[model samples]
Target chain A: MERLMKIDRRLLYLISVALVAVTIFMPLGLPVKVSPLAVQTYDAIQNLPDNSVVLIAPMYDPGAAGELNPMLKAMLYQCMERGYKIILGNTNWTLGVAIAHDMITPIAAEFNYVYGTDYIEFGSKPGGSVWMQSAQTDLAGAAIVDFNNDPIGQFPLIQAVPRLTQEYIAAVLVLDCGTPGAVEWLQIITQGTSIKLIVGEIQMSVPDSMTYVQSGQYNGMIAGSRGGAEYEQLVGRPGAALKSQDTMSVIALMVALFIVLGNIGYVTRKR
Target chain B: MMWLLAQEQAPVPTLGIFSAGSVIDFAIVLGLGVIIWVMVARARTGRKIPEIKKIAGLEAVDEAIGRATEMGRPVVFIPGILSVDNPQTLAAFGMVSHIARQCARYDTRFLALNCDPLPYAVIEEITRQAYLEEGRPDAFNPDDIRFLSAEQFAFTGAVIGIFERERPAANIMIGAFYAEAMMLAETGSFQGMIQIGGTAMTAQLPFFVAACDYSLIGEEIYAASAYLSKEPVMYGTVVAQDWLKIVLALIIVVGAVLATVSPDSTVLRDILGGY
Candidate 1:
C-alpha cells in the first residue's frame, strides 16, 4: 500500500498511456452542444459569398495537433462546400510546411477541390507579428511563395487573387495553440479593418479570448477540443471532436472529484 | 418569435454525469467540498499547524523588488497575457499587488503592462489599492498601468520595448504564459533584469526554468497569492488544494494496484474507469 502511494512517475505514465489507449477504443457516443463561437464561425463561412477570399493562419505545432486539427478540417470542409477560396499560411516555421504539404492536400482531394483554384498554401513565414503587419500590407510579398519555391503568383489561384489587405480579405480564420497567433490578427489587422476574424484557441487560452469576444474585437472564438466538438454539432454533423468531449468531461470530473474526496478523507482521519 | 424558436431548438447541456466514470468525479467533488468546510471550521476553533514547506520562487519577491527599488528603477509586472477571470491570472495579480505595495513603500515606481482590456481595468484597480495600502496613493501612476495591444506577439513586442526603454531592474512575469514565455524572459535576461516567471503552462515551464533566475511550476503558481497575501481565506484555499493533492495521489495508487492485480476484471475497471 505504501509503495503504491509513492509509485514512480514512469510507471504512472505507462498506466496513463494504457488508460488513454483503452478509452480511445471505447467510444461512449457522448452528447455535445454547439458553442456560440463555433456556430458564429460556421455561419461566417457558410454565409460568405461563394469564391470569397479567406486567409487561414495555422499558427501551431504538432503538440497542439490533437486540439486544433479537427477545427481545421471542419473549416476546410465548409470553405470547399461554400466555394470560397482559402489562402493557407503559417506563422510557426516548423509546422507550417507539414500542415500545407501533408494535412491539407488529401482533404482538399476528398472534396475534389483542385489546388490553385479552391486553395493555395504559401508555406511558412518565420517573422512573428512583424510578418502579420507585412501580410496585411502585402500578401504575395509577405508569404512570397508556395511549399515549392515556385512563385505563389505562378499558381493560377495566386495570380488571379488580389493581395490581402482590409479590402481583399473576406474573413481571417486563425487556429492558434500558442501566443503570437490570434493576437497577431486581433492587433495588426482586425482592429481597424472590416475583415471578420475568428479564433480556434486551446482550452487554456479560452478565458483570455473571451475578453476579446466581449470587447467585440473578434467575431467569435472556438476554445479547445470542447469548442471543436461544439462546432461539429452546429454544423449538423459529428466527428472526432464530438467523441473527444466525453473523454475531456470524464477527465475533468475525475480530477475535480478526486480533489474534493481527498480533503474529506484527510479531515475525517484527523478527527 | 425568433427568440422562442431558437430556445426551442437549443438543447440544454447536461451539467453533470454523462458516464459511469462521472460517478467517481461527483464523489470526489462532493467529498472535497465537505472536507474544506470541515477544515476551515477546525482552523477557526484554533488548531494551529506547523510551518509549511518553503517555495523558493516566492521568497525572492522581496529581493527582486528591493533590487529594483535600490537601483531607483521601476518593477515591471506582466500580470499575464490572460484576463482577470482566469483563476491563475487573478491569483497572480494578487501577488503583483503585494509587490507593488513593496515598490511604493520604497518610493520605487510600479509598472504593469497588460494585454486584455478587461483585465487591464481590474489590474489598474489592484495597482491603485496597493499604492493606497502603502500610504502613497499619490505615487500610483495610472499611465504606468498600460493597455498594450492585445495581440500576443504585439503585446510581447511592446513589453520587449518597455524593457529596452525603462530598463526595469526586476521582471516579474507571473501568469499563464505560452510560446511568448521565453520571448519575455529572454528579453529580460538580455536587459540584465532579475527575472522571475511562474505559470501552470506545463510545456512552457522548461523555457522559463532555463532563462529565469526563479520559476514557479505547477500548483505553486496557484498558491502564490495566498502565500504573499497571508489572508486567511487564501490560506484556507491552499489547505483545500493540499487535500486535493493527497486524494489524487491515493486514486493513482489504488488505480495502479487494481490494474496490476486484475487486468481482466471488468468490475474493477468500471470502478476505476471514467465515462
Candidate 2:
C-alpha cells in the first residue's frame, strides 16, 4: 500500500500518454448524447430561410483551434447543406484566416459552392470591436479585399451583403474563445434586434456564455467540443469531434481511475 | 368640440427635462460621482478613513520582492496578454508601478514582459518612472522590458524559457489572461517562485488559485493599488465602490420581490434591463 501510494509521477505520465495513444488510434465509438443547447443551435441554423446569408466569424486564434476548429467545420457543413450563402471572417485573429480558409474551401467545393456566389472569405481585419461596428454599417468598406487580397467588389457574393444588418445577413455564427468575440457581436450589432446571434464557445467559456443564451441575447449556442460532436451528428456528418468522443470518454475514465486508486492507497497507508 | 379635438390632436408634452431613457443613467453616474467626491473631500480634510480589510495577495507583494532581492534573482512581472485599452490592464499598470518601485528600493532586478506592443511601451515607461521616482534611475534597463509575442502560446513558451534561464525568485502576473494563465502559473510554481497573480478573468481564477502562492480574485485586483498605497483619496474610491455595491444589492433584492409579487410588472424590467 505504501509502495502504491509512492508510485513515481513519471510512470503515471507514461500510462496516461499510452492510454491517449490507444484511444486515438482505436476509437471505442462511444455515443455522444446531444444536449438541448446543441439541438437549439442546430434548429436555429436549420430554420433559416433558404438562400439566406450567414456571417461565420471564427473569432479565435490557433491556441483555441483544437476546440473551435471542429465547431467551425461542423457549422460550415450545416450552413452549406442548408444552401446558405456564407461569409467567413474575423478581426485581430490573423492566424484563424488560413485555418478557416483551408476548412471552408474543401467543404465548399464538396457542396459545389461557387467562390464568388455561394461563399466568400474576408480573412482577418485589424480592429477588434471597432471592426465589428464598422462591418455592421458597411462590410465592404471595412473589408476592402478578400482572403486572396483581391478587391471584394469583384465578388458578387460580397456585394449581396452590403452590411452585417438583419436585412442583409440572416445570422451571425461566431466561434468565440476570448475577448472582442461573441459578446462584442451582441453589443455592437445584434442587441435589441432580430438578427440571430449563435455562438460556438470553448468549454472554459461555456458557463459565462450560458447567461446570454438564457437572456435571449444569444439565439443559440454550441457549448463546447461535446456540443460540436452532437451537432455533427445532427447534421448527419460525423467528423473529427465525433471520432474524438471515444478518446475523451476513455481519458475521463482514466482520470477517474487514478483519483480512486490514489484515495485507496491513502486510506490503506493511514490504516 | 373644437377645443377637445385640438387637445386630442396635440402631442403630449415630453416627460422630465432630460431624454426619456437617459435620465436614470445620468442620475446614477451623477450619484456615484457625488459620493466619490464627497468621500475624497472628507478624506482630504484629515478625517480618519475606515480601514480596508487586508488582502493577502497584495500583502505578499513586498515579501516576494524581498525574497528575490535576497536571492539575487530577477523579479518578473507579466501585465497579461492584452492592450492597455482594457481596464484590467490599466489596473495592472498601477500594480507594476508599485512592484517596480519596491524592486528599485531593494536594488533587485525587475523584468517586465508583455505580449502587446502598445502596453509594452507603456510598461517600459511606467518601470522607468518608478525607478526614477525611487532615485534609482540607473537601475532601469531597457533590455529587461520585452515584448515577447502577440501569439498566446508563443508568449507562454518565451516566458517559460525566461523562467528557466533567469530562475526568478518571484513571478507577479496581473491583468487579463486567457488560456495561457494556467501554463504561466504552473511554470512559476515549478520554478519554485513565490507567485502573486491577479486578474478579472473569472475562468482563469481557479488555475491561479491552484498554482499561485497568493491570488487576487475579481475586484480585489482593482482595489490592490489603493490598498498598497494607503492613500486616503484612493481609499475613498474603494469605499464609494463598496457603497455602490450595497445599493446594487438592495436594488436586486427589491427587484426580485417585485418580480415575484407581480410577474407582469415591467417596472423593474424597464429600469434595469435596457442599457
Q: What are the DockQ scores of the candidates, in order?
A: 0.03, 0.15
lDDT of 2 at B37: 87
The runs of at least 3 residues in candidate 2 whose Cα sits more than 4 Å from the true structure, single-residue gaps closed, are A1-7, A257-271, B1-34, B37-51, B231-234, B273-275
Residue lDDT tens for model 2, B1-275: 11011111212333645533456777789999988888777788877666678887677999999999999999999998989899889878878889999999999999999999999999999999999999999989999999999878899999999999989999999999998999999999989999998989989999999889999998898789677766666778888888999999999898889878987788876775353
Q: Clashing residue pairs, candidate 1? A: A183-B151, A257-B28, A257-B29, A260-B31, A260-B32, A261-B32
Error (Å) of candidate 1 at residue B150 is 1.0
lDDT of each: 0.75, 0.86
Runs in model 1 deviating more than 4 A are: A1-271, B1-23, B41-46, B49-51
Q: Relative to the unseen true structure, what is the C-alpha lDDT of residue B235 in candidate 1, on a scale of 0 to 100?
A: 63
lDDT of 1 at A25: 88
User: By lDDT, who's the top model here?
Assistant: 2
